[model samples]
Target: MLNDLPIRKIIHVDMDAFYASVAQLDNPELRGKAIAVGGGGARGVISAASYEARKFGVKSAMSGRLAIKLCPELIFVKTNFDRYNEISKKVRHIFHDYTDLVEPLSLDEAYLDVTANKKGNPSASLLAQEIRNRISTEVGLTASAGISINKFIAKVASDYNKPNGQKTVNPEEVLQFLEDLDIRKFYGVGKVTAEKMYQKGIFTGQDLKGKSLEYLEDHFGKSGSYYYHVVRGIHNSDVKPNRIRKSLAAERTFSENLSSEIFMLEKLDHITEEVVKRLKKSKVSGKTITLKIKYSDFTLQTRSKTLPYFVSEKSIILETAKDLLFQEKMSNSVRLLGISLSNLNTETSKIKVLEAKEKAVSVQLKFEF
Candidate 1:
């Protein structure tokens, strides 16, 4: 039935090593060399690392000190948030030129539903290639795109190529593509789950397809159904223009700006705790959590991460924010702090089953600072 059903074309576009690659494009000297941006002090963590840096085993979230040890000549640069935002806008504008069915996952990645595109190319893969080219030619940054009949397949295809690459997966080829893939390649499967699948002898999609849905649900909980469809190339997920959010956030401006590091931490503790309680009350774990800090100089900086797992614990949420704050390095005095969570989904919602061990729905807690 899926083979005969009318297809909805989708394209997933992602900027490669987004933050670091943007840095390289802006600074010619940094090209082809190991470079990292953001909180680079003794206690700081690498926010973004260039492909060159990755080659030296440097990585984002690695301690700055250790990153330097890996690539002694690594160039550590302070972040230019304004610049990145500017380029993000430009890149988004380019996408809009082709289709309005665009959904931004972040400043760097987006899902474009081109079921009916402006250029009227009809072929999703062709449009994907054109968009990739437009990004490189217009924004001076390389991008990768995956085009397919649905959201899941397109996302998988996009990553098949590296910087400035495009991949297309149609209905017929979808089965083969998935059969060769490992269990961990599915959306929700992480390191721990992958190992569990391996022990269950589900080394590939074919192995996973052999198990019945009932068995998978019995073993993997609510996620069993999700695993079933993915391996069979039967994803029915939509490329939402904008997924509705489950949480709302508000911030108050202080009459007077405060500047004590000790005081800031104390305040953040309460704010983050309150946010966590709200999340639990909703019976949700936000995959995208944002931490906002404003300085006396009228400047603001925020960091966020989307985790593959969900959690509702106060201690875990607060600790993550605390890590980001220290990692970002407070540049000046503080005026305000705000925390918001989005990308929330119901914990017990049913989804496709990929493998026997791959169906547990861990509340996706986006690991953002």
Candidate 2:
């Protein structure tokens, strides 16, 4: 079965310290310094830290207080999504120059299928090098590239050499590489799953591959099938170029927490306006509205309501979000409020329909080996 699958040239490109790097690139003084990009306070969190700051154990999603304790000299810069988005678009344009089959996971990373790219370059490794060089020259930011036969291996290899480097796993070396890889390093195996695998004495890809298909299935359900095949160098998930946007959201944290319902309503209305504006800009509407609240005590709550029809107008979003907000009783003074729209109507709906038809047809074609 593995031999029947066609080989593909996939490349995963990831930016190094994207947010912190951009901050340094735009501000000369921040270059070569320990910096963290995010809010800095008791309620703040680090979004991204430069390599210098990381030396002191500062990392994204860590509390700002903890980050500061680790590196007192760490400079914190507020996030600028608009600026990041602009730079990300420029980076993506470079990818498009090579291949249209680019699947962006985020602003900082993407997977490219260059098996039949416009460049006519048969070497995926060389193409990855060219892409990295172009990004460094044109965008003034560093990126790491990993070239392999599949997306999973490419993504894993991209992280092997951090900051700025590239790794290529040739077709012949794929099995040996997979067999030697640590179970924790396999994509989709989170901390919990890794711990579970550890307890079961399955600490490496070889151990996982040794498990019977029935045993894996009994242990991990559907994911067991994934592990069963992936350990033997099989991952058929394509780099979907037309991945749909699941949701759109806007939120803000207040410097001073608000306890008054009137003040909360006012803030919700403001957030709703921001969300509606983004929806309009995206040219999409949704039937599901969600209201998120963060309290001064650091507790969080969310209320969501799905409507019968799609709506994107500011007034309607505001009214619906307000209703959802009021439905939940405040447990503490609010520090943050957010509004979002989901169940979006777009080309994604058509794609889903097509996929469903394809799946139905394939179900009848399936045969046991």
Candidate 3:
């Protein structure tokens, strides 16, 4: 039904090894080597590791001791989430420039609803390219993008190329793309799910498209609903516009350019305190810390880090942001400083989750209506 419906433009963005890549970018010594961010201690779990480290069998959530055994020279640095979180915000704002319909999957990936984009662009593929270019040039990070008529196909397209890559599935090409797709390549199709599909003689999208809706529901239960839509190459999910304010942050433009380290920290403390006050009133708890800086010549940068758990303390947020600021010596004077906390745990998000299910039903009802 979706394939037959009037085609709408969509884009999916996925960042490659975001945390580890950023570390390699800032520190030239770690580039092209098996670098894992975490400790070599017995309990240290790899928070993020470079692609090079992955080849050595290193992976996130794996123990550091095991990682070293895989790659003897495996470099392990303790995670500094304060920096990564800051960069997340910078990229998000950049995405907003193209479209307001952005659904962030995590710190590194998102789905963009670009059907009626602000840029007046007709081609979704061209829009995806422009967005990827801005991310690399403005944010100093490479990102992979996928463009298609719907979110499901867009997501599949983005991963076709690795870092700094993009691909598109236009209306005319959708059927061919689906015909050649492996069942495993479909998102949400786990190995177990794929094996089950294989049992049902479904190895590809063509096989899947041949199955009747009732037969699919009888075999796959709830997943049948998802699959029925996927075969047609669309995810009927809407981009949620209700952006719950997790952390309130403000940036002030300084009359005089400030270059001193102590000056930066002093400004950070003030901004962080403002964030904490908003968190308290909103009854929010977040462990991740983010810092944003704007240069006088208009170059912008951000850094952030996520903590093991949620915390809304002013001292903790400020300290984390302060560490990131100090890590990058402010050679050029900074014009503005801002702070925000993500991975936040709030009652608002909890409430929004409940609403999402109702919203999904409402979306379906719209078509029925």
lDDT of 1 by residue, 1-369 (tens): 466544567789999988898888888989998898864765567889988888999988787889989999999987776688889989889888877667788789898866655676667777778888888898888999988777787887888887678888776777888888777777678888789889888888888989999978888888888888777767766555544556634343444566766776777778877787666655677666677887888698888877687666667667777777777667887777887777777543123222211311222211110
Task: Tell me the spans in candidate 1 whose CA falls farther than 4 Å from its real position.
Answer: 245-262, 265-338, 341-369
Tens digits of lDDT, candidate 3, 306-350? 899898888788888888888767758888888888777754334
lDDT of 1 at 338: 82
Off by over 4 Å in 3: 243-369
TM-score of candidate 1 on Cα atoms, chains taken together: 0.69
Give the winner by lDDT: 2
TM-score of 3: 0.66
lDDT score at residue 81, model 3, on the 0-100 scale: 58
TM-score leaderboard ranking: 2, 1, 3
Q: Which of the two, 1 or 2, has more TM-score?
A: 2
Q: Is candidate 1 or candidate 3 better by TM-score?
A: 1
Candidate 1 local distance difference test against the native: 0.75
Clashing pairs in 3: 81-304, 81-305, 82-304, 82-305, 83-303, 83-304, 84-304, 85-304, 86-303, 86-304
